[model samples]
Target: MDKHGNSYDKALDVFEKLLDEPLQKVLSGPLPLARAVGLATTSGYRAAAIAESEGLLSRSTEGDYLRGPSTRTIGLSALGFGEFALVAEPVLIQLRQATRLTAFLAVAGNSQCMIGPHSRGRGLTFAVPQAQYYLPSLPVLDDERLAEISLSNRHEAVAAQRAAIAAVSEREDRQCIVGVLLPGLHEAATDDLRAHLRKASDLLRTQSEKLT
Candidate 1:
């Protein structure tokens, strides 16, 4: 019997003996012993019987089986994979404050892009408030400068997002890379937006380092 009160030691000994034999020879050799043990109503008695039959346990003159030092098989439960949110809430708030422009957060999950909390500028004359829009497709950008600004300002976040993006790129359901962006900003404020995003990214990076 094992520490768990199961006769796994005998079962292991029988299994090891069976493993030494070739697959084709198993049926004619120790396989019958294993099958009998597996079908036994009492697992412990079955294991002992298999061990004795397989010559793993010695039989005494009185016909009693003597146990031997052997390994055992222990059952294990499956482990769960926990979910984690990489970007912190403070980072989003900082990005909003720094840019004074609309800021968005996103993550890649289940072959789709999930947009998280977002903030918009209070004084903006144009542009709609798109807080939690799940864009099944990638963002359509008419201005190359704005795209560059977004990438540059959210460098670290973008890097993590790109890694996730690369994982799902081959799949048909895969969405665009994860990152933050400002929608419907003015063409004239592209440079300023870029500057603010850079500042926000830098601040976030600094805060992250301190936490480490």
Candidate 2:
């Protein structure tokens, strides 16, 4: 059984693998179905056929596999139909406008962060769109400590290419990390940026509480 108490099913595992492989190499272009069916068993090929027929996977003209219509529909629905996204979107936009930097909300857990809704900044920005980041240096948060983290200088050393300042707020049993991505912010403006980020995070918490 998994953490959700669902029994493991091999067929579902193979199906998920097929979807994940192409997405992992999305920038590199389509992946061959055979390659996606890593360690191809009889069941693997069967799963691929069903996924293609159900519009979860599509084949390129040259016969390589990429995500299909169903994936797009699901992604769109996730962004459009969520109360969390709706509440965060306006706050993110405000944060971006105030700081001239990309602002985002991510679900923080399991030593990794999965970025969700975000507002993009103008000109050049170091925004990590639809990306998952693993930070070994970040310790698991206890309820009391889920307030904020000043990750500007520390994250500069950890990520090397990006710096972020974020705050964690729990609302309706969900822990959301709201932050801003700094492209090339001046050292003097760090304090102002942190203030804006905190205000945005507080707005999210207040709005989310109203929904409950």
lDDT of 1: 0.37
Could you give candidate 1's per-residue lDDT for residues 37-152 as a string of tens digits? 35343554565466656544544465433332121111000001011112334554565666555454443334234443344444652233332333334433333312322221
**TM-scores for every predicted model:** 0.32, 0.50
Q: Which candidate is the best by lDDT?
A: 2
lDDT of 2 by residue, 107-139 (tens): 555454556656778776645555666544353
How does candidate 2 fare on TM-score? 0.50
Backbone Cα, N, C clashes tallied per candidate: 0, 0
* Alpha-carbon deviation at 105 in model 1, angstroms: 2.5
Q: Model 1, which residues run further than 4 Å from truth?
A: 1-91, 108-111, 125-189
Alpha-carbon RMSD of each model: 22.4, 8.6
Stretch of 10 with least lDDT, candidate 2: 145-154
